[model samples]
Target: MKKTLGIIGGMGPEASEVFYLKLTQATKAEKDQDHLNILLWSHADIPDRTASIEAGKTEELWAIMAKDVQMLKDCGCDYLAVPCNTSHVFQDRFNTMMGGHFISMIDEAAACAKTVGTTIGVLGTDGTRMNDLYGKALRRNGCTCVYPDKEDQEGVMHIIYDQIKKGQRGDLSLFLNICSHMKAKGCDAVILACTELSVLKNNYAELSDPWYLDAMDALVKTCVTTCGGIYQGNL
Candidate 1:
């Protein structure tokens, strides 16, 4: 039996699109309806996760995302997923709204990172960093989380929110530099906790000895499993 996949998206419109496309390819169904049943709410008006985190605007952001989740629930979605890593800020809020069983990219990524090794570096927006969503999940799974320096994290935020999420892609040198530093810091792996990092994966041939974990890839894999789809990714 096939299940419907409801997406709480538009945190960054590009990641929402990427999630849809990846889910389609993963499902491998010929026709549109044959593909995974997806209900997407691409509400670009949702407040920025980075800004909300840095400026302590959590209530405003979650309120917007909560409405989206409720709409998906009202639409009769069987399960809910948010493609944005930072939007997981509202996990607790969504849990309270949806009864506490939402599929989480943070947990999925943490489990995947454990398979790769125990110590990992996290690259995400300010909200994700400040809130320690990924870091907390990693700790729960017997993994240690290393963070980029303050300036490096700021750089990552700019690249993701200011650049890639807006569909402008260039200047990956800073990201590469961070990867090198993580590897040097003895990280066994690194989780790209921001879904927008999906656009930056092809720039290098494996930046370091430490494995690279893409949170978007983890979400796609979850979708594949829930919808009986085929997933092809080495992360």
Candidate 2:
């Protein structure tokens, strides 16, 4: 039997939608009722995660996220996940407060990367990048971490916020250039640490695997297996 899943989302509404659709695609189901019961709070009004981290509004972000957790709890979910990678800077605190399991997409991504290569490159928002969130996690998993240079970092932010978040197809070359930079730097594998980038990955079937891993897909597989459901993996 599959346990109920809770999604604390809306860090960017587009990312939340991608997460749900992928979750559905990743699940093994024969009937409409076979899907895990998911309680999604796609609250678009929550403070922007990157902005909150940059502006020192951690408390405001936490308070609002806490309400989302409580609301999910009220819905009786057994496992919880937040689709936004940038928002995971507070994952440790959330794990403590969660009534059940709070799956860490960051950790899952790192683990997935470790299996793919010895040196991994991560791409995410400034909040996540500056904090070295994936860096710490990837190191712990016994993989070396590589990151985009300053100009490439700005390009990453642009693809996420200026394009994908705006529901635009986001400049593919912008992302590919960042990837090329990582590969040039000896990155054997690259993680799309941002959910918005996962959107790009989903749209572009040409992005080869093992060379690239989607953190959102890791979350989907983990959520499925952790909740006692079979995963129909696309990874």
Candidate 3:
């Protein structure tokens, strides 16, 4: 039987949309019924995750997410995927709160990276960087993780918030520069740890330098596999 995939999304609405689209693109469906069942709760009004974490107060954010998880469960979702990277810091708590229905995008991404190489570069928000969500998970799977310098990390934030999240076409040059820096640092591949950064995959076909493993893409694959569907590969 096919399982229903629940998405606790809208950390930034654009990223969630991309994730949903990826899920559709990744599935090998010849008919509408062949596609996996997806239930997306795009609560765009939820508090900013990075801001709450930086402020040292995650309780409100956790409460909102936990409530959403319960709602998805009540709606008959069999499995869950969260598109946001910073939100993965609350995976353990949310799992417990939701009685373990939550799927860890961080873990999925780490597992994917493990198959590719042992050394990876991470690109995301300040909260994701400070939390080391990707680093710790990848390390557990025997992969070493590297990150861009402070200045470059700021550039990443600018692209995510100032550009992508705001619905502007982000400057690909900024991303290329950071990927180049990570390559110079001996990273085998770079993980687009932030869902907001996942939007860059659209421009990836144009460049061939830094190989990227997108977290949202990993989550889409996980959703398909968990739902007993085959991933049709990247579009």
Candidate 4:
């Protein structure tokens, strides 16, 4: 029996759409029915994760996400995927609420990074950086995680919010410059830990450099595998 995959998305709607498209493109489907069953809840109204985290008031945020989890469960989803990286800071709470049905995007990315190299760079929002979501997971899997310097990190935020999230084409030069900075810091690979960055991965052809592992891609692969579907590779 094939399982159903649930998505708790719309932390930003664009990233959620990317995740869905990747799933469709990755599945080895010759017919419509061959694709895996998916239940998506695109709730764009969830409070800003970075702002909530920075303010030290995540209780309301947690409540909103927990409600989403319950809705997925009620909808008969077998496993859950959240596209937003910063939202994984509530993994423990989600585990408790969902009883281990959540599939972690960070864990999947860390596993992939472990195969490629020992040192990796992480690029994401202030909330994801301050929480060390990728850093802790990669380190636990025996890899060293590097972060952008203060200036570059701010630039990362600008690329995600000011450009990609606003539906503008991101500055490829800015994105590559940060990747080059990570390479200069001795990182063998970089994880695009933000879903908004994942949007960049889908939209920009320039990201084909192979040095970046996108969190959304990781989640798509996991969703396919968990639902007992074969991944035909990115389309």
Give me the candidate number with maximum TM-score.
4
- TM-scores for all candidates? 0.90, 0.96, 0.95, 0.97
C-alpha lDDT of all candidate models, in order: 0.79, 0.87, 0.85, 0.88
- Per-residue alpha-carbon lDDT of candidate 1 for residues 1-235, written as tens digits (9 for 90 to 100): 7767788777677778877877776665666666677788888888777778888888887777777888888898877888888888777777677676478888898988999888899998877888899889999999999999878887888888678866787357878888789889889988988888866663345543337788887878887786655555454
User: Poorest 10 consecutive residues of model 3 by lDDT?
Assistant: 201-210
43-157: candidate 4 lDDT, tens digit per residue: 9999899999999889988988988998999989888888899999998777677678788999999988988899999999999999899889999999999999999999999
Query: Going through the candidates in order, what is the number of backbone clashes in each?
Result: 0, 0, 0, 0
Question: What's model 1's overall lDDT?
Answer: 0.79
In model 2, residue pairs whose N, Cα or C atoms come closer than 3 Å (at least 3 residues apart or on different chains), thus clashing, are none
Provide the RMSD of all predictions against the true structure, rounded to 1 decimal.
2.3, 1.2, 1.6, 1.3
Error of 3 at 141 (Å): 0.9
lDDT order, best first, reads 4, 2, 3, 1
Displacement of residue 7 (Cα, Å) in model 4 is 0.7
Model 4 lowest lDDT segment of ten: 226-235
Q: Order candidates by TM-score, high to low.
A: 4, 2, 3, 1
Q: Per-residue lDDT for 84-203 in model 2, tens only? A: 998898898778878538999999999888887889998989999978999999999999988899999999999998988888988887788788989999998888999999887877
What TM-score, to 2 decimals, does candidate 3 have? 0.95
Q: After superposition, how far is residue 46 of candidate 1 from its true place, in Å?
A: 0.2
